[model samples]
Target: MLTLRSFEQRDWPSVWSILEPAFRAGETYAFPPQISEAEAHEAWVEVPAATFVACAPGGAVLGTYFLKPNQPGLGSHVCNCGYVVAPEAQGKGVAYAMCEHSQREAVGRGFRAMQFNLVVSTNERAVRLWKKLGFTVVGTLPRAFRHARLGFVDAFVMYKELIA
Candidate 1:
């Protein structure tokens, strides 16, 4: 079983361990591959409205995610989130669980919708999973992401309304 909770200062190291490789891979997130720990902490923790961690039974972190407004002012009703799961925990349901948890948290925080601005097209698993979770591809940006290994690739703008 897994548990999700607010991020604590002590969770930074484990969160960074999970985030470092994925950010370095440059395959999914748009962050610079050589981002410094301080820069990453500022982006992942300081900037977001809230951050959370997913932990195993023994309290070992399995993943982390952040939630923030997709835009400011009138657009703040829509939120954005980024997720990263430990490599060892991949193929499990960590991402799915975190996503579901995020939606509930978003609604509670007064966000009416959620938007993923740059879902790299090459990330088929994430695309499929988001679709399964009821998000729609509202638009596609042609050659939007310069994937680490695939050069330039398209990206999708995925969105889902949390309330009618």
Candidate 2:
């Protein structure tokens, strides 16, 4: 079974292990592939309103996610989130659970909506999963992401209203 909880300082190493490959791949997120551990820590943990980890029964972190306001002050009602699952944990519903958990957490925090600023169009699995979870593509930025392997690719700005 998998469990979710607020991230602890001890979780950083495991979280980094999951995030490093994805960020290094440069296929989805826009972060520089060469981003250092301190930079990633600040972005993933320090900057977010909250961060969480998905763990296995043995306490192994299977995935991680962060939640933050998509914008400041006037636009703060809408939140933003990012998720990363260990490569070994992919296709096992970790991302799905994290996304669902994020929505509930967002609503609890009084966010009226949730937005994903940059969903790489080429990441078909994530695009399909987000759609399955009721997020819609609000807009698309053509060639917005310069994928390390695929060159430039379109990116989607996905959003879902948390309130009725």
What stretches of model 1 exceed 4 Å from their correct place?
A: none
Q: Tens-digit lDDT track for model 2 on 2-69?
A: 89999999999999999999999999899999999999999999999999999999999999999999
Model 2 regions more than 4 Å off: none
Q: How much lDDT does each candidate structure score?
A: 0.97, 0.97
TM-score of each: 0.99, 0.99
Each model's number of backbone clashes?
Answer: 0, 0
TM-score for candidate 2, residues paired by index: 0.99
